[model samples]
Every structure is written in structure tokens, then in C-alpha cells.
Target: MTGAAIGGGLVVAWWFLPREYPNPLTPARGEHVLGAWLKIAEDGVVSVAVPQLEMGQGITTLIPQIVAEELGADWRQIAVEPAAAAPAYPNTPLAKRWISLWDPATAGLSGGVDDMLAERFATSNAFTATADGTSLAAYEQPAREAAAAARAMLAMEAADRWNASWEECEVYAGLVRLGDRRASFGELAAGAAGQSPPDPPPLRPELADETPQAGSSEADAGPAASFPRIDLPSKVDGSYRFAGDVRLPGMVFAAIRHGPNNGSELTGFNVERAQGIGGIVGAVKTKRWLAVAATTWWSAERALRAMEPQFKTQYPVSSEDIGARLDTLLTAGDSFKTHETGFGEEAMARVDMARRYEVDPFHAAPVETASAAARLSDGRLELWIATQAPEQTRAAAAKAVGLGIEDVALYPMAAGGSFDARLENDHAIEVAHIAKELGRPVHLTWSRREEMIRSRPYAPVYTLVGAQLAGEGEAEGGGAIDALKIRAATPPSTHEFGRRLFGNLTPWAAIRETTGMKDELAMEGMVPPYALPSVTVRHVPVETGYPSGRVRGNAYVAGTFAIESFVDEVAAQSGREPLSYRMSMLGSDVRLAACLQRAASLAEWDGGLDQSGQGLACLRIGDKETGGRIACVATARQGEGGLRVSRLTAAVDIGRIINLDIARQQIEGGLLFGLGIALGSPLAVRGGLPASFEYADLNLPKLGDCPEIVVDFLPRTDGTAAAGFDPGELGVGVVSPAIANALFSATGLRLRRLPLLSGGL
Candidate 1:
């Protein structure tokens, strides 16, 4: 990979190489791990091919933009593909997602998504990843920085060709143009490739610096505010190749009929019956399931349909059994108050006078989750995974297959309906292991029933909360809340909060800790946007048989409902108008004010004056500085047998509006997610398995559920660009709170539990 000394005549090569491996976790340097990649092709496309399969969430759109920013190539000409699991690629997501999962504090305070954070790490050659260099924290910046540096190198090359200073040569939309002399990136590829890769690449500017939809070409020497998302068109048109579309000469397909029970391993299989069918390649048994391989998916289906295998039941799960268990769990008293305060003798004196009520909202639905891929090769494994943790599977698969990480190439394609369940990579890792053992191109997609049966699902949550009236001027009502605490981490974060109001239910420190705990305390309580004299929140971390990981908003779902509903409880007791109560509590928070005004306008919230009903939920995502801040207002109407969300409006004070359209899209998506979960979202489970095998039982939000989504984003005038993720989704998350609040306004039900307690079926 040598480069010439000539300025404009420089040349570079992005070579595709497999990673060497001993242990798959952290490969030696110069080996691909997962997220990171280094490729030198014949063209100037110095590539950093990732092994992490993109399962939507703008993965395809975001990565290419970063590469173009780094490679200085025309964004249109850049091509990015999933790297194979190897020491070279490491099979991790930019090496940064891992780190972010490990420690979120290093992600910084602001909602900034910097691509440089990922680039600072070494090649995917290591197994033990760091948060700063290999975590999800740098997901936004590392690649962007790398792309910008490549552009700088290319600009220098072009400047040399024109016999001018590099400053005179500008990169415009993958082109080198100086006055009348201009050439596309493709034309200057050879010259740019001839130069050695530069160190310490520059990052793109903040959103305040660049216009939306403008490619890097618009930048003045430096990386632009936003790189052109080259994959946008392909993904939009459904033209991009996904893993499901992979084709090999001798590739075959397979299907499995597994017991609908977790931990139900293989018992036995009858190959004679399967062998009687035509095109029945073979039947492999594992615990309680039989995997049949055939020339086509049809043949595999027919063989399985032709014969039913017998199995010994190990805790055989039925729909009825699951429902009974869930009901029992739900009926049980919530262990204890996650955030209980004013409980001492003096405080108890006041509790005797305050009116008390219980609000137990549970968002329960059955979701069938499946992740499977077709196996085409054995020595070199290719996986199609349905997971957000793409890198984890790639590395884990390589290790599981007794192959170096590079021997496994994971190509992420389109995915089935996904949620937080996609973050765990066990589905991919399991399929990869089974496919290789067969020595055939095996397709292992789960059945609708299988998805529900063998679920690594989020446990059903139940919460109990109690509050009392304040005595005299002693922080009456929900005063300042003193401090907001949250304890949402792995076991390492248990007891992170002392016995304080804030530290009880919403333990804030645990979230920032290194422990992998997903706060059990916040199963339904989170940060409140409402201001009081003193506010505090905390959580009690608990690790159960099913470690509740990224289960639908982590703490957002439970916490929002708990916090917002509790606020309403206070409002009801005081007989104060809900809107007025919230406003008074918020005081003068700028961002909250913006969201309230917009939402109120959308719903015509006139202090309970008109025919319209108003509901609002405050979002306190990021701090003022880290950006990505937002506020949302949601208004809904209850009709016969259905709830109509007439209007939902959001005013996001995040990232200074890099692209209003994109920001709005993100918010809308989040709304659908949160609203649907609030309404009739997933299927139900009885014993530990999903009762609903398909969408029919687990209904999603229909087109009718779509309300007018009015988005208002804060421009750079407020501050520089901030984090984009929270701002995008916070609006969607809390729409339910707003709707519930509105319902309380209209019906005076004051329902507190989720799947909101209703009168009608």
C-alpha cells in the first residue's frame, strides 16, 4: 500500500482482507474484530468494511455517509458491504457500539454522535473492546472523521495535479474542481489512492455549520456538516442486496420445527419419516426440534408438513398456561416502592392526611421474534442475522464455528419487524453454529410458533407507587423533586442509589455505570420534566431469571408511564387543572415551554376551556449542553371502541435541525413505536411463551392510528448540533402519556396502568 510523493497524482488501494484469529473476542492487531475494517481497493476507495449487519435504524444510510466523509470519494461512487467475521473486521459495530454498551458516561454529556470516536480505535484486531474507541458512543463520529480525512488527502492530490496549492482545489460532491478545471471523484481516484493514508482526520462540522441534504461537496476544504447518504436511494428503492437475497450456486434452504419451550433441548428425531419425502436433504435433531434441509424452502416445508415428530415435553408451554402465569404475576403485590420518600415518622404524619391511590400500568403484548439466515459455505461462513448487535454475532459466530473471525462474513439484509429484541445476537450465533454443522447451505428461519415458543423476551413488568401530600411550605405537592435519581444497570449497579427519594426509583448513576444492568426499578418510573422545589428519582436494580435488557425503551416505557401518571395523580388530588399543574411544575424551562406551546396549539389546549381535549408529556432526555433535547405535546380523543389520536405535535430542541425532514421522520417513527405499545401492540404470553403466533393476535398500530404528526425542531439559533437519537424518538415514546392524560380530561377516569385501563373491551 505504497503511495507516490506527487500531490495530485497520488494513488491508494483499499484491499479486502480476512481477519486472522486465535480467540474471536479480541483478535490481535491487524485483524478484523467486528465493527472496524480497513480495505484498500484498486480504486481510491479506502474502505472500512464493517461486519455488523445493518438492521434498519438508518445503519445503511449512516455508514456510507461516514466513509465518503473519510475517503473523499464521491458519495455516489462509494460502496460498503458487510465484512466477514475475522481478525481484520472483528465483526463488531465500529468497535464503538461495544464500548457504549459497556459504559455510557464516556459517550459525553451532549447528544453528539461523533464518528471520530470509532476511528480512534485500532483495527478490529482486538477482542477486549474499549468504550471510547469501540463502543456505540462513537457510532456517529468515527466514520465521519475517517471519510473527511480521505477527502483531505484527495484534495491535496488534486491540488498537485493543477499545479496549485491544496487550498485552491476544492472537493465538491465527490469532485475535484478548481475554477474551470473539474473532474468527478471517479476520475481522480487513481491520483488520490497513490497517497499514503493521513493520520488524525478532521471531523465534519456541527449541524449549525451545514445545510441538510447537501453532500460533502458543499464543504469548504473541511468535512461538511452532513455527508450524502449514498445508500439512501438503494434502500429506499428496495434495490440493495440484503442477506435474505443472497444467492450461491449450491446454496440450499432449511426449516425447523422446535418445541415452544425455552431451554427445551433436543430429545430425538425420526429421520425415516422425513427421508420418505422427496428432496428431503436430511433431518438434524437438537433437543426438542428437528431441522430439515432441502433443495428449496418449499421442499423443506413439504417434508416437515408431511410428518410430525414426537417429543417428550419439558415444561410444555400452552397459551392458557402462559396467561395464567402472567395474571398471577400481575396480581402479585409490586415488591416495594422503587422511589418511596416522606416515609419517616414526621413524614408519616402528613401521609395520614393525603388522599392515596394506586396506579399499576402494564404494557403487555405478545411479540414473536425470529432471526435466521441461510448458510452457503462452511470453511468461510456467511450469516444472515436479524439483530441490532451485528458485530457481536459476527465475532461470536466465528468463534463458535471454530473458524477465525475473518472466515465468517456476515451480510446484513432486510429484517422482520424488529424492536429492542434485535439487539441480542443469540439468534444469529445459534443459526450460524447449526448451519455449519450440516455442511450444507442451510436456511434456518424460525416459524411463527417457534418465535413465540423459544423467546428471549422481556419479562412482564409490574410496578407499585405511593405518594403523600406535603405539609405546610415544606416542598408541598411534588416540589423541586430535590434530585432525579435512576438505577438502571446490570447487577454491578444494584444499590447504586442510597435510600433517597431520587435514588430510590430512578437511580441516575447506575445508568452511567459499567455494569450491564437494565434498571429493574424503573420498570415503570423515569425522569420527570415537571419542575418542583426539589425533585429526586431512583431505582432498585434487580436481576431476574430473564435479564430485562433493551426491552422497548429500556426505562422509557415504564418510567414515563409511572412518572407522568403519578403527576396526574397529584393533579387529581389537588383538583388543579392537569395542564396548569404541569405548567406550574415546569416553571420556566425553555425547551419544555416550546414543546407545550406547539402541542397545545395542535390540540387547542385552552386550560380546559373548549370542546377539544389536551394531553402533554414532558421529555427530559439530554441536558441543556449535550443537545438532542426535546419536548412533546400529544392530544387524543376517545371514540366508540377506539381511541383516535387527533393530533400529536413535538418541538425538539436537538442537534440544531441538521435536517428538519429527517428529524421529523425519526420522531414519527418513534411515535408509532410508543403509541402502538401503549395501545394493542404485541401478542400475549401465558406460561413463558407467546400465545399469539402471528400478527393477527399481536396487532400493530394501523393506518387509522396514524395521526397528524406536527414536528417543530429548534434551529441552530438555540445551540450547536446535539444528539439526534433521543430527540427523534422521545416524541413517540410519550404520546401514550399524553393520550392517557387526555382521556383523564375527557372521561375523568384517571387510569394509571398501561394498556390503559378501559371501560370498554
Candidate 2:
């Protein structure tokens, strides 16, 4: 891996080059690679290999948009196929090879990049990009290049046939035209088949000597723009394929019975009763798990229930116990201060006023429970799964089946929903294990209760916000914010994930422990956007028994809720309006200040306050990890039920917006997600398990409870932030803080902890 400092941050580039992988899009004619990611069929149906998983965030739609934009193909004609589980689909070449620099000024603004040629890192065929809010930022450029590569070939072929210069031909809407001559991309593709393709453009156009990259910025010019999502029609018609919808010729249903506690080893099980059960094929047993296979799913479920498996708990930890321990750590002051600046603890010591805020642990409940289908045929393994990380699924399934990566093929299925769910690949492994053992195709689906119990929930947070004001009108640096310190006691999801993924390797663990670096996912929103002179931010890592992962904004939602709410408090103390006070401290951060101002104005912040205890709040979302800007203003009222968000207005600057409909929808979806967590979705830990293990107990927000949201895009004319957008998780950061701020304005009663009113519930 190599890291390059570009723009304001480092962009990590992986050493792994894009390799040719079998194309699943057109399997009948065998796979043909066109610049790693692009594969042109003889029929002229341009198939672009997409690395990112589509979990209904419109990634699959946006990816095709970029390709169609560059390829000049009709959006309808282009097929957006899921890239197989191979080296071709990792994260992004830019992120893999470059360590993005964290810009402080923009850290508060969520600014986009400007020069694409200067920043486009490793371009490979590997569809190696994680699916998150930043999917657009991570995959857009590569998608552009892949489409352009195939288009270039078509243009070259057209130019050759017309006896004209390649530059004289233009590709548009699936046709190549030169002077009076014209040919469809399908015609050109057919002619170019079996013929030597045109040479690929240089990876970096500015430096011809540089190795050819897949998504070169220079080759990204085209006229493709927004189009209706391609996947929606099938989804609406119920023809879209999910893992649960998969069927194989000789498929057998398998049901799993995991240990009471995650990671517990299986002790023993009585399978005699289960075997005698009608339709029961057999039972596969492992030290850590057990599964029953049968001719039908109902029978498998029944047989699995009958085989009372015993599991030896490795640890006597419960959810309540973890909560109690976290409380102790919060008070102990023996935690690692992950981030510190200015006077650090000294500033907090001098504070005259302080407030403590806490957000309890929460679970993100996706409607779909885990499901997978796997088959071992002719010494080759195949799997169908709904996953956000398909490459990881492929790798895990291969590892579980004891097969080489090439022997295992993963057919990506459209997920019903994903909130950065943990065990995104766990269900695949389970299905693979059962199928390999039984020597028959196996389909496995986790029960809704199982999904709830095994959910990778958001960690509980304890935050202390302290500020010392300099006598009235004597604010520090002419800003309302004086000496400030934010101490957060958060369950370390990254630490836990690292231990789980690499704990068995002592050498890797030693290196990780010595480095003491937390994963970016864990610290998503830890950084403060404000310009506090004597600021100090500390993170105390606490362990939670269950696994945790990114669900929307992750720490950003939790941390930002505290910080933004604190900012509101400081503004109130300084005798200033929340919006004005925040803008005053923003200083030179024009982008963020602009967004806040825009959202406030659009929200009519001053027109009419919610007399029913209405409050207002703002959120800034542009950081090293997510390369975009989105400012949100939300209003809430104390209703009989709880905090009811009446309206939400967001000013977004995710550079260039792709599909306006999808972008807005993603932001809206994010707001609903944050509201769900703020209003409900609290995970109660009791007896080493989440007490709210099902929908009935989780209290998920429904459509009827959703607030009317308005999303406005900031004026943008093709710039840095335009190159990529992180709309998928954009609503997560702003919703919690905005709602919290609104709640305060309406009720004057500061409900700091998550679920807004933990006590009321």
C-alpha cells in the first residue's frame, strides 16, 4: 500500500493492480475485459462491473449513471452488473492507495475537491470500494473511466471504418457519429469483437509518463446526466432478486441455531429427534455452530428447533453488565484521550459551567433478516447473498469452505436494507458451511428474533461538554465559544472489530496495538466543526459485550448530537440565537456557514418558532472520511407520544448532485433513520443480550411518524465536492443534533441522552 498527500488530506492507494476477472454479466460468451471494469458484449449492451453493493441507497443506479454519462450509451441499454467476489472489487483505488488528509477549515464545511487529475489515485479493475454514504465519491471516477474505455474503443472502431481521425468521431446515446457516417455502439462493439481493441488512455492525463489508471479524470467528459433509477421498476414489480428469492434445482433448506451468546462454542446436540422428523436431511455440527438441513424450509426450521443444542458460554457478560462497566469507565478517568487540542484538560478544569450528555446504545433494525443460499457443484462453490460488502462475503465464504478464492463465486443479491450491518457476510458463511457438509445446495435465513439478538448495534455514549465564559461580552477570539472541552465515553467499535478480525494473528494484533489507531468508521463524527481556541476532545474507549458497527453515521451521529447540542447550549448562554451563534464561531469556514445560513433561512428559523416547545439545530458533514457537505436544520415539538419532528430542511453541497430524486431520497431516508434512533430504537441490555430483540420491542419509527423534510442543494458548478457525494449516510450526522437542538428550543428542558427522553420512556 502507498499513501499520497493530495488536496488537503492523504489518499491511500493499494499496490494491488486491477486484474482480469470472469464477467458474470455475459457468462455464455465467456468474459472479456475492457480496461478491467468495462466489458462490451457483442450485442452492444455495455455492461459496467460495479464494485459497490446496492442496499437500496441507489448506488447501483448512480454507478450506471456515471458509466452511461461517459460511455454515451442509452441508460436503458447499459446493464449494471454486480462484480463477482474477486480482487477486482476491493474498496476504491483512491482510498486503498492514499491516506486522505483531514482539513480543519473544510472539516467544519464538508467541502468537495477541485482538481480531479491531481487526485485520481490508483485506477484498477478491482471493484474495491466500500458501500457507504461516500459510495459516489469512491466509485464515481472509476465508473466514468470504465465507460469511457469502452466508448473509446467504439469511437476508434467508428473512426477506422469512416477513415477519419478518432477525435472526429463523437459517441452519444449508444451511437458513434463522424461527419455524415454513423454507427450504433452495438454495431461498433460487434465489429471490434475478436479484433485488437484501441489502446487505453493514460491513468493520469496530466502526466502521460504515469501508469494508466482506470478512472482518469481527463477521460470523464460526457453528456450523461440524471435518469430514473433502473432497479426501481423491478423492485416495484416484485421481480427484483433478493437472497431469499433465490432458488436452485437441488436446493435444500437449512436452519441455523447459534449459541445464546455470540462467539460461544457449541458443546453438543441431540439430533435423533430431528433426524426422525419428516423431510429432515441431516444435521451439520461445528464446535461453534449447528444447522439442520431438510427438503423444505419449514421442516428445517422445525428440525433445528427440535435438536436442542447446548452451548458453553465463553464469557458471563450481559448487556446490563456491559452498561454498568461503561458507566464505571466514564467515571474512572482511566480512558485513552483519542483526540486532544489546545489547552486540553486544562481548559475543562477552568470551565465555570458544564453539562453532561449521554446517548444509550441503540440498534439499527433493517427490515430484512439475514438470508443466504449456497451450493457446492462440481468442486466449485457458488453463493447468493444480500450484502453491503460482497468481496468480504466471497473471502469469508471461501475461508469457511476451505476453497481457493477462484473456486468460490458470489452472486450478489439486492439487500432489502442495510445500516452498515455487522455479520453482513456471516450468514453467507453459515450457508456455505452447511452446503459443503451436506453436499447439496443449502438456503439459510435467520429468524427475525435471531436478527435482533445478533444485531451489531450503535454503542452507548457518555459525553461531558464544559465551557468557561469570559465575563459578559468577553468571549474568546470575539466568538461566543470560550475554553471548551468534550470528553466522550464511547464503546470502541473499531477496537472490537479489529480484535475480532485480526485477534488470532498475534503479529498483526501487536502491530495494531502498538499503532493505537482507531478505524475511521469508529471515529466518524468525533471531530468538532467549531473553532474553539482552548478546545479539548477526548474519547474513552469502553467495551460492550456485543459487536458494534457503522449504522448510518455511527459515532458521527452520537458524537455530533452531543457537540451540536452543546453548541446550542453555549449559544443560549451567550444570549444569542442558535443559528447566529454557530455562524459567529464558524469564522472563515464559508461553506459550512453558508449551508447553515441557507438551511436556517429555508426552514424559516425566525418566521415562527414552534410554540409547542419547538427547537432548531444544525449539522456539518464534510470530513476526511466522507468527502462532501450537508447542513441540516430540524424542528421538533414535545408531543404526548415523545419528540415529534414537524419539519426538517437540509442545505446540501455534495459537489455535483447525480440523480436529484435519489440524492434527496437518500437524505430523507437518513433523517428518518436518525429520527428513529432519537425517538426510539434503544437497545436494552439484560442478561448479556439486547432486551429489545424484535420489532415489537425495538420501537422503530414508521412512515406515519416521519417528518416532512425539504432538501436544497447549494449552488454548485462542477467542483471538487461535485466529483463525489456521501448522501447515503448524510442524514445520520445532522438529524440527531438538529432534533436535539429543536427539542431544547421547544421545551427548555435539555434531554441530552439518546432516545431523546430515556426517562420518559
Candidate 3:
């Protein structure tokens, strides 16, 4: 049988099975349960359940806005509840997208968004991971459906009391009214709970959207955000609670130190020295790590420093060794084809132009380090932490303490910032072991140095791009491409990450499992968006001793840096304007072309003339019809201090806008993040650890260093009900190339590597 047929059979069998799931959101005494997603309070407050983490992404408000917009509730009365992990809230879209990671054997069986197999697997496992910008895609419809159902029920109750037909009643602004008679949702909350909703709930005709008025000033833009962020007040007043804020009656602080490299064994530590420290509780030693617990975190950290733990590794990872491996692989190693179109390799027999680009590994460097609080009592473990994959964290904690999965209670907490760093559960496992050993509550936190040593960085990549001209006798300056080929030498980072995340294997074990596997995700965004006759993208997986995993922007950051930099070089060689050269190739990508045009206009295009100090780049995230598009223009100069970026102008088309304020915030933040990558240190590794641990050493752009950024969203002309794409990572991938191109214009020199000055000008 075909894979789809097997998936269909499983779906049929699953429907007949008894699947009873407890509601994660329990209503308070005065609140009535509307649906799994929300509850209506007697005081007219609507509490919406949000399954995704609020790591400064405004999801806490975004999800609630979707619910309130659909239910016609007042924005001021809407509240947010961090939902617990349950089968009721599964990120189906993410599950489908990551089918190959979780179940490699049956990955090909169901990878579609609507596949029942993906839904069943996600629901059964309660896989509510928050990554890849899939929150809006996965939870929007479910939230809307639940809100719609509650709206109908409320209207029915109010209609019965008024002796009018429920179909004739209108619900708006928290009120259910029939002509003049009306009742607040709060007043009908008890009766609505007993009322049966329509078989198919009455849904609003349009999705939530807003269009920014043309020529609007910064002051005018403030009013466009109809529903302000719910967490803003508490965040400003220092009342917002994160995982690190968790406290228990008998809780003690713990500090841990892990081996520098994976597979390293902890030799020993100065137990006598650690015990002599004041306020020291005790120390727990494991094969791979040592943890010191004390009355306060400072004492615990001090104890660890005094103990001086020693580790032994078979081979320590170093930047020299990694660079040597990439250099050798890029020239002669075997390659596996990951993506192809049209003629594939048949048309790439002869290359007209070729360029090589190298990108060093990048650290996520989230403000918050790994932290988790664990308490074990009577074979039950309660964990408080911010994790992208809550179920995985819970399972890891349970296994560490030798307890059943059900014997764990996980309290979801907001993260300070993850950037995919929180996906790893080592801290969760460590806290569980410490709590179990100590027989008391233990809050474990890794120091900055320890975080840099233990956390995985983005894989370094070496890429060689070749292009063929359109005609046989065409000059190099023709600026027309016939074929393109890309060969990237890097570890199978995503595949390795999948093994660690889904298979629950150690980093070294995961690397062993996916040694020579082909990873398309590692080569994502390699194919050019322009019209090309033939293209071939290849991945050469090279092991570098050290493990690398997911970071914000994933492979796109590296891919775009290579492709866009090469494109800009091509434009310079062809004696054509950068913007026009790109525009000519965009045959059917009208959205991206529009973005480029608008961005240029916004920045007052100067045609990228010599010493103009302006550069342009554009990118598309998904597909042509339903994807996020972005174009960025950067203004930079070679100042006395160094490369100084004065301004950045961006035009984005994420289909229909959901919340204009949040969208702009994401784009602006992503741009600055990309700027950091463009100019910050390469985070070179030495002796199996990062060379620098302090944030100050990274040379990141501070408030005074930040450039002026202007972001504008294209109004949706297709319709009002268009699907909105996630704008979180779009700006991140496009800014580096734009900045690179800008520097080239200013200096008349081409820097063909990430961190443009890594090798020195």
C-alpha cells in the first residue's frame, strides 16, 4: 500500500479509539468554561489559553487578540493564560514539518499539513514545541473555532431569555443583543455553559487584519495597534515572572559545570575545597558533570570555582581542526544532492563564474542562560522552566529521576529569550537529578561560561557557487544566468539536532546516528528566488568533532549570505545596477520585486553608485502564493571606529497583517540581530570551548551603535482574508547581505565572508 493509504488507515483506526484528554485550562470559581481554549469570568473577563512560549515575541497578546476578535470581546477584558502541555493543544504544523526528525522510519508516510497521521502523532505525543515560527499557522484556526463556538452559545442563552431567535441575535463588544434588548457575556456565562452551540459554529467572515495608512507618521502608527500587548505593563513594572523567578519554601540554589566537549568524562573535583566554602550545601557528581548546591546561588557558584572540576576528552574540538576539515571537504569530499530543479546537474557541465564564501559558527547568546527549578517528593517531580519542547523536557526530567512520565508536573514559564537555545533539556535533566539526590527543591542555573561551553552553536559552512551565462558568446557583463550550482560543506546540523531532540540521544550519539545522512534543512534557501533554467544544491556533510544545532534564522542566514553576496558580486562584474540586475531576474516573483522597489524608494535609491554607501537585498520565506517576503536596504560607511551602519530601510509583505505593531517589532529586532551577525565576532572555538563568554566580548551593537531602522508593510491588495505569514525570522536572513553589499559600495572592496572583517580588511 502507498504511504497515504497507510496514513488513512491509521486515521480511521484512531477515530474509533477512546481518546480522553483532560482540560489543561481549569476555570476558577467565578469563571465558566467556554471551550478548551478559553473561559468567561462572571466579571466579563475572557481568559484565553496560549500554548506557545512568550519569549518576547508578543505571542501572549497575539493569540488572545485572535480569540477576542472572533468572540467580539472587549480588548481590555481579555487575559492570557500560559497553557499546560496536553493533547488538546498540539502544534500540528510543526509536527508535519518535522516528520523526518521524530520518526525517520515512517517520515515519508505523512508530511502534509492536513495529513491525519501528523495530527494523530502530535496529539498523541502532545508535541507543542514552539519553534520555526509555526505558532500562528498551528493555533490560529483552533483558537478561532473555540471562540466562535463560545460566541454562539452566549448568543443562544441571551436569545432564549429575550424570547427571540438565536440566529437573529448579534454579538459584539462583549454583548449579545437582539434589536434593543441585550445581555453582557458575563451575565450569560452560567447559562451559556449549558447551552448547546451550533453544529458548525458561526465564524467571522474575515480574519484579523490591519492596514497602515499611507504617509502615516510615527505618532499616527501608535493608534494602529488596536490591542496593546498584555504583558507590557507587568514587564515595565518588573512584575513579570520568568522561570528564574520561581521560588519554593525550601528551595536551594545549585550551580553546575559540564564537560567542555561531548563524550568527555568528568575525572574529579576538589570535594574538600567545595565543602569548605561558607553556606555550601553539598555537591553531586556525575559522569559528565558536577553540580554544587548551597543556600544562595553566589555560594554555589563560588564553590564550583573553588572545587575546580577536571574532565578528560578523547579529542578536544578546536577551530583549527574544524577549519581544516571544511577546507578538505569543500575541495574533494563526496556530495549528496539535496535540492534540484529543471536540468539539475546536466546543465552545470561548464561554469561561467564561480565564487567561494565561508561562514564561521555563530552562538545564539540569549540573554538568559539555562535555568530550571525541580522539586521531587513521593516519587513525583515538579519542574519549572522555559522550554520550547515542554513534553521533551518533562520526559528527560522523568528519565533522569527514574519516574514515570505521568508522575511529573510541569509548570510552564516565560523565557527571557531562547533563540532556539532552550530546546536542549540538559539543565532540566540536571535539576531533576539534583532535586532527587538532595531530597529537596533545587533551582539549577548554568553560569555564562558554562552556557557557552555546553550550548551548541550554529554549524559553520563553506560554500562554492557557480553560475553559467545565458548565451555561448555572451560577455560576463551580460548579467543573465542560464544555470546555477551550489556546494556547501557543513555538518548535518539539523539531522544531528533532530536525533538529540526526538531520539533523546546525547550529542555524540546523535552525531553517530546521522553521520552521512543528507540534510536538506542544512541547505535551505540555497535555490535562488529569481527565474533560472537549471539549479542544483548539494550538501557535503563533514564531521567537526564538536556538535552544532539550531539557532535563530537556521540555515537561511548562511545561505542568503552566500547567495546574495555572490549575486551582488555578479552585478558588479556585469556593470549593472544591483537593484536592476535583481529586478530583471524576478520574472514571476511580483511580491518580492515589489518589496525591493518599495525599499529602494523608501531609502531614496542612488543606483548604488560608486561610494554611495547603499546596498539592497531581497528574500522570500515560503512559497510564491503564501509566504513572507522582505527587502532590505542598508547605508553604511568605513568610519574611523570601523564599519558604521547609519540606517536600514525595509519593505515587507507578509500577506495580510495581523498586528502591525508586533510585526514591525519583530522585523526591527531581527534586523539588529542580523547586524550583530554581520559585524560581531565569529565565536572561534579553542580547547573545546568558545574563546569568549562575556557578551561584551562579542562586539555586539548597543543602543548607541544601533542604526536608524524604518520598516513598512505592503498593503494587501489580493483581499482582506489573505493568510498572514510569520515575520519573526524574515528580517534576520536579509540584512546581512544588504549590509555586505553596502560595505562593498562604500569601500570598493569585496569581503566574501561572514563577519566581513573576520580576516581583516
Model 1: per-residue Cα lDDT over 454-538, one tens digit each: 4444433433333444433423643323333322221222122211111222122232331334343343335555554333333
Model 2 residue 655 CA deviation (Å) reads 1.3
TM-score of 3: 0.96
What would the per-residue lDDT of candidate 2 be over residues 1-761, giving only the tens digit for each residue?
24554543433233232335444445337335465566666666777777666777887777777777777777778777777644434454333322222121222232234122113222232334354455665666656666666777777788788888776777887889887788986667655544454556412221101111223322132232547888888999999888899999988888777764445678887877666679888888887678888888889888877878887765546756766766777768555555665666666546666888877777668888889899898879998887765555676788888888678887877778887773346677788989989998888988776777666677777877778766565244232656777677765565454343323212123223423333344554766776666776666666555556447677778778878888777767666666767777765667677678778777777722435444455555565333456677777776687667888888766655566677777878888888888887567765555565568776777778878888776644333333546676778777877777777667767777788866673
Candidate 1 positional error at 341, Å:
12
**Top candidate (lDDT):** 3
User: Runs in model 1 with CA error above 4 Å?
Assistant: 1-53, 66-80, 83-137, 197-237, 268-276, 309-378, 404-406, 414-417, 471-525, 531-549, 608-611, 681-683, 721-728, 757-761
Sort order, lDDT high to low: 3, 2, 1
**Candidate 2 residue spans exceeding 4 A from truth:** 1-33, 88-90, 93-129, 193-225, 268-277, 341-349, 474-479, 499-521, 607-612, 624-627, 640-642, 717-722
Clashing pairs in 3: none
Q: Which ten residues in a row are the worst by lDDT in model 3?
A: 216-225
- The best candidate by TM-score is 3
Ranking of candidates on TM-score, top first: 3, 2, 1
When 1 and 3 are scored with lDDT, the better candidate is: 3
